[model samples]
Target: MRRLLVTGGAGFIGSNFVYFWKKKCPADLVVVLDALTYAGNIANLDAMKNVPGFEFVHGDILDTKLVERIFTDQGIDTLVHFAAESHVDRSIHGPDAFVRTNVTGTLSLLNAAKAAWLDRGSGIPHRFHHVSTDEVYGTLGPDDPPFSEETPYAPNSPYAASKAGSDHLVRAFHKTYGLVTTTSNCSNNYGPFQFPEKLIPLCIANILDGKSLPVYGDGRQIRDWLYVDDHNRGIELILEKGQAGETYNIGGSNECMNIEIVRLICDLTDLRFRERASLSEKFPKALPAAGRASRELISHVRDRAGHDQRYAIDARKIKTALGYHPKESFEAGIQKTVDWYLDHENWWRALMDTLCFSKT
Candidate 1:
């Protein structure tokens, strides 16, 4: 069994990956390292705390010493780098943090890996997999073909640019230092344990609180949505069968407009309220409780600066090379997302309160 070290394991996509990995490979020792940043919630992994072969360490990726120690102490042979400052607007307002975390922090990990695994001829069998996003390819025209592995870097936002820089670092380390490395750039992910700041979760939280649903621009921006577990499965395929020093794109092939997704969530939430009488008591301010439509709260807001119009991933490389294919469609994924938020009220409610997100 592999000894895996997953950074950012307390965050949204990372937490989902942790769960997916442990269930699929129960014999492996899984050590999670997270900074517990604003977006990283240790509570997300509460259920897995007592599970055998699972351990969590609260720390930062930039601390190269701590990372090296983990590599040596835990005998970590697989490094899944998911730590990053990921919000676009936050990156625009504070690019320094993004650069420090995404670019410099990635470099720190690479250095630590080289020291522990390669230095002094230790030569431990190791794999460093960097997780990235399709935003590094920049935007696409409505009719342009989806982003392929050969897509040139044209990152639009600070977050995307920082990620692109990190991707280049991973490639450089592999090429220059003979490090075994792989990178996967995934499409938009939505599913359980997602922080409410994102589009789908934000809309669900607002609908339940009877708050306005803010829509950016004309709300027609298109994005490919992959369920979080589906993306994690792709990662598993890469680790098992992928060649080192290669890049793979993972996507659901589910392209949808932003407004369309909001409306879908609205309809789904309304349906949930209708199906369950207890939900009305739990969330008294919910739109369905007042005989109001969730869409009625949709309000147009100013568009974000440097917002890319669309993003899509070709994902042919992974499917062909590693047999990676997302099984969940947008309808199935979003329905699961809606139902998750409905059933786990206390989880999101506590997270929202801690983050102090304005519901009004």
Candidate 2:
């Protein structure tokens, strides 16, 4: 059986990928290494706790010794790195942790991978796949085209800067030491199991609680949205077939402004609950007062510092190379995501009380 090490496997995209991988490749041995940080909740992996081929280790990627041990003892044939400090607002508050986790931690993993593979001699049959974001391309204007694999690095926020640094390290390792590495830069991802701090989840949670949905600035910042499951599929395809030392961009071709996304969620929620009330033959107390729509909950807040005006990805490379296509539309994906939050209140509620979401 092939052994794979997936870092940050307890977080949003990472966890989703792990779940998909386990089902798609049942014979593969999957080991997950996570720090269990505020954002890394073990609950995300609760369903797979007893799976035969799954293993979980609570640790930080910065721990080189632990990483090396995993690579050595597990005879890991593949590495899918998704660990990083990814929150932009948190990076703004303090960049030290970002640098440590995103920059230094990546270097640590690369060093360990190189050492382990070299010790194993020629034809190690190993591949290292790095997961990254398109924010490293910085912002784009109205007429500017989407970012591609060759886009120059122009990161803005501390979070993006740290990821950019990690991306460079991965490239250098591939060029300098002949490490078999592949990197993927993806657009924004939204779906189930996301912490309630990000834009989509935050909006859903606030609206459900009857709180004002905070929109940064005028809420006009644009981002390309890729469903989490679609992204997971793309990562799996890249890990299986992408050429070493090559970078691929993954996007959904679904671009929408922040305000547009918020409004769509509000309308979906309103319709969903309205129908629920009708079926139950009772007035829905959750609905806003008559004549008041959920859109009234929207309140524009102060803009974040160095907020990227827009982000879009030219995903032609992944599409052409791997024959990958996203299966979910933005409207369908957002409806499912909102309905997920509505049904799984206990999951997010436990996280809010335990994790430091207030800081996020």
Which ten-residue region of model 1 has the weakest summed lDDT? 351-360
- How good is model 1 by TM-score? 0.98
Clashes of each: 0, 0
Worst 10 contiguous positions by lDDT, candidate 2: 278-287
Give the per-residue lDDT digits (tens) of candidate 1, residues 117-179.
888568678999999999999999999999999999999999999999999999999999999
Against the true structure, what is each candidate's TM-score?
0.98, 0.95
Q: Which stretches of candidate 2 lie over 4 Å from their true place?
A: 120-122, 278-291, 354-360
In the range 1-360, model 2's lDDT, one tens digit per residue, is 679999999999989989999899998999999999988989999999889999999999999999999998888989999998898988988899999999999999999999899755746788999999999999999999999988899999999999999999999999999999999999999999998888888877666666787788899999999999999889888988899999999999998999999999888877777656541222233444243578988888788899999999999999999988999998889889988887787888787665343311
lDDT of 2 at 268: 83
lDDT of 1: 0.92
Judged by lDDT against the true structure, how good is candidate 2? 0.88
